[model samples]
Target: MQQLFKNYINTFRGLSKEIWWLALITLINRAGTMVIPFLSLYLKEDLHFTVSHVGWVMSAFGLGSVAGSWLGGKLTDMFGFYKIMIWSLLATGFLFIALQFINTFESICIGIFIVMMVADAFRPAMFVALNAYSKPENKIRSLTLIRLAINLGFSAGPAIGGLIITGLGYAGLFWVDGLTCIIATLVMINVLHPKKAKVLDEIKNEYPISAYKDGTFLIFLLAMALFGIVFLQYFSTITIYYKDIHSLSELQIGLILGLNGLLIFIFEMPLIKWLENTTYTKLKLMLFGVVLTGLSLLVLNLTSWSGILIAGMILMTIGEMIAFPFSNAFAVERAQKGNQGEYMALYSISFSIAHIFGHNAGLQMTYKFGFDITWYLVALVAFVCAIILYFLNKKLKTITN
Candidate 1:
């Protein structure tokens, strides 16, 4: 036991101080993301809102994300990462705390908009910093460590949130999340704040935020948009599906959902090293992941048992872990030096755009067609995404090469 523990630390010894700090921040941020798992529960049980109302509120977060990505990129180009990140952290923390008092959807909408914009702005800055700090060979490793930290927090957050919700209810989850954000804000402020000299270099002479003009970068963004639209079902409708359709127990649901993050934590390092050499084909994994995710849902329709559904979810999780790290790495590598935030922001924008239509459409399908039909519809979208990705990957490869 002692030998294994020492070896584990030795393996990760290659990680830089900055990457370690980023990893720590990743943990904090993911703990914040845990609130989403219980968001619907909170809205319906605590806020006394309808399912549709919850949808609208969640959609508002997506809108904020859209604004955040564009504005964050612009600000990173103008003001620098440290300032944007520090402000973003404090703003999100305050928003989480403020949710303690909001009464209506309209108020919640405005609050979430501010929270997401600030939180998302910091997200791309962290990505930019990670990319800048990596030493060529360690890019994927750095990404995987970041992913692992996040998944760890994600795994813990939901289980803890679920328990808190069960015991003290939604407001309890909010207080805990608010506290997590406060600490995360402080951590980012102290540990990861970038130097002022570096800020001047990025901001001086006023570089155009025309990061959208980079053709390969644009193609990468679109590919990921399609990928995200396909991937979100794992979180959105699927959570509801497990409860309403499969009649899964809360503990079982936690286990099934938690498996994804656990596997990612265990497998990410080895997988990153193996995939280190892959380039434009990075998108191919995403294509396959979507297919696998769609296929899992398809298989779920054929099974009424909780065990089978759990198995299918495990498969979908594997696909996600495989796909996302590659997609993120591709976006970072394609950007010019000093413009990583803009590039990552551009990459993130694809997902934000996909969400605008994906969830609304998904809710409609779930209501009108039943869980099985929703699965089929999600499958079709994933299939289309896979085909488009394959075609675009070839074009991107030719252009990039």
Candidate 2:
């Protein structure tokens, strides 16, 4: 056990101190990420909206994410990540608090949209910061470390969110969520501010708009969009599945989701570290991950037993651990130094587009066809996407090499 623990520490040993601080910031921010995971439930249970209305609310959040990612990238390139990161954190915090007052359907949709827009804007800047602080060989592990922090924080968020919901209601969830965002913003102000400023200056020194023109990247973006649509269902559609189909309460839903984070936190970093030494290409690893994702979703159709949900969640989390960091690494490696923000922004947008279509469309399909058929369809989409990504990765290697 001691040696195993030592190996895990060794996996993360050599990253720059700034990278650690960045991971800390991610931890603090995501620790309060209570609102979104439960937002669909909140809208349904508290606001008494139908499942279709819940889809629209999630889709609205996705739309804001799209705008924020685009605008954040442009601003990060122009002004540097430091200023953009700080403001985004502060704004998202305030917006979470604002969501409590919105009671009407239209009002709720607009509020959720604005909050996601402001909150998601933080992503591109954070990616840029990761790139700036880490060495080339360490990039994937650095991303893994950050992801581990996020998972750890997320593990806490939902479990605690469940308790808060039981005791203080949904409004209390927002206050705590917002307060953590503000706390993270202060950490950025005091701890990460001065050190990351030089990295931001370096980012600003080169500015290229060619990420839009890269054909390989465009195909990669498409693949990401498809995968995101499948993966994000866990966030939007699956919560509904748990509540409506399985008849679980909000606290039960939180525990199940929290299980996903707990598994990732325990396994992701070590797995990625081990992968670093393997002969596997990034695409191969990604293909494996995507396949697991399809299997995870398809398993639901095979069984109605709630215990099977754990199996499905495990598969999904494993797939995430394998796929997401490598995908980010591929983008970073392919991007020109001056345009990291732009490339990362486009990458962020893929998930946002998923948000736009995945939930709204997913719910509509489920409402029409039922969960079994809907999940089967999602599995099929994953299968097709994996095939495309496999070929595209081969083609990209030929082009780049």
Candidate 3:
């Protein structure tokens, strides 16, 4: 037990102070993530929007994300990540507040699009910042640490968000969300001064390639986008499923969703650390994670029992833990061989594209055919992507040899 505890604790050693501050900033920012998880519910229950309307609004959010990510990445390369992060946070904070006032379907769609455009720009900039703050050797663990903070915040956010909705209504969620973004920006400004933070020496490639021209990396991104589509459903349509199908309360739903974050908080670091020491390739682990994620969806169809919900959540969380950090590390590694900003931007864009399709597709399928069919379809997509990734891995090895 003592040795086991030591191994777990050792996972956190050797990270720079800037990485810690970045993690703290992420935690503060994500803790206020009350709005997105409950956005579908808010639109449906509060504004009386139809399911299809909710899908369109969410797609608008995704479209905005793609634009934001691309812009942020481009700007980060030009102006640096510090300015981009600050501006993105401040703009998004104000937009969240503004979004609360727009009630009409068309107006709300535009509002959400604008809000997400400003907000998601933070993602690529944050990745660039991660590259700057962390040592090359510590990159994956650093990513995992940041992810831990995010999950920790997510664990708290939904439960607290549910309570806020209960007491202060959906309006309160926006206020809190806006305020948190502002506060996180303040923390970033105060602590993470650009001059003080140690920027790592860049690893130069013999022949730097444009992210756009890299055929192998592009295939990897396509697989990632598909995996993202499967993963993101837990945040969007799945919430409605818990409520409409299982008749779970808002608080219950929030707690259940929060469980994903909580489990990642406890288990992910140790798991990543352990996986790092294994002979298995990162691609293989990613493929295994994809398989688990697909099975998580398939498990939903096997029974209507509420117990299955926990089982499915556990499967998905484990899959997420295994897949996301490694995928992030892979993107960062690829970015180092080219224009870091552009490479990371394209990586963020892939997931943004997933957001574009995942929520609307899941919601539409559930609305028309039923939840069972949606699950089957998404699960099948994930498995197919896993196969693609498997082949992509083999192709990468052939090139290396």
Local accuracy by lDDT, each model: 0.72, 0.87, 0.92
Relative to the true structure, candidate 3 reaches a TM of 0.98
Task: Tell me the deviation in Å of residue 97 in model 2.
Answer: 0.3
Of models 1 and 2, which has the larger TM-score? 2
Residue 373's lDDT within candidate 2 is: 92
- In terms of TM-score, which candidate is stronger, 1 or 3? 3
TM-score preference between candidates 2 and 3, better one: 3
Per-residue lDDT of candidate 2, residues 33-103 (tens digit): 98878888888889899989988988998999998998888888888788889999998888888789888
For model 1, the local distance difference test gives: 0.72
Instruction: Pick the TM-score winner.
Output: 3
Worst 10 residues of 2 by lDDT: 196-205
Deviation (Å) of 114 in candidate 3: 0.7
Instruction: Judge candidate 2 against the unseen true structure and give its global Cα lDDT, from 0 to 1.
Output: 0.87
Worst 10 residues of 3 by lDDT: 200-209
User: Candidate 3 lDDT, tens digit per residue, 1-401?
Assistant: 89988888899999989899999999999999889999999999999999999999989989999999999989988999999999999989888988899999999989998998999889999998998888988999999999999999999999999999899999999999999999999999999888787787455567778999988789999999999999989989999999998898889988998999999998999999999999877788899999999899899999999889889999999999999999999899888878888899999999999999999999999999999999999999899889998998888889889
TM-score of 1: 0.90
Better of 1 and 2 by lDDT: 2
Q: Which stretches of candidate 1 lie over 4 Å from their true place?
A: 1-13, 193-209, 249-251, 277-280
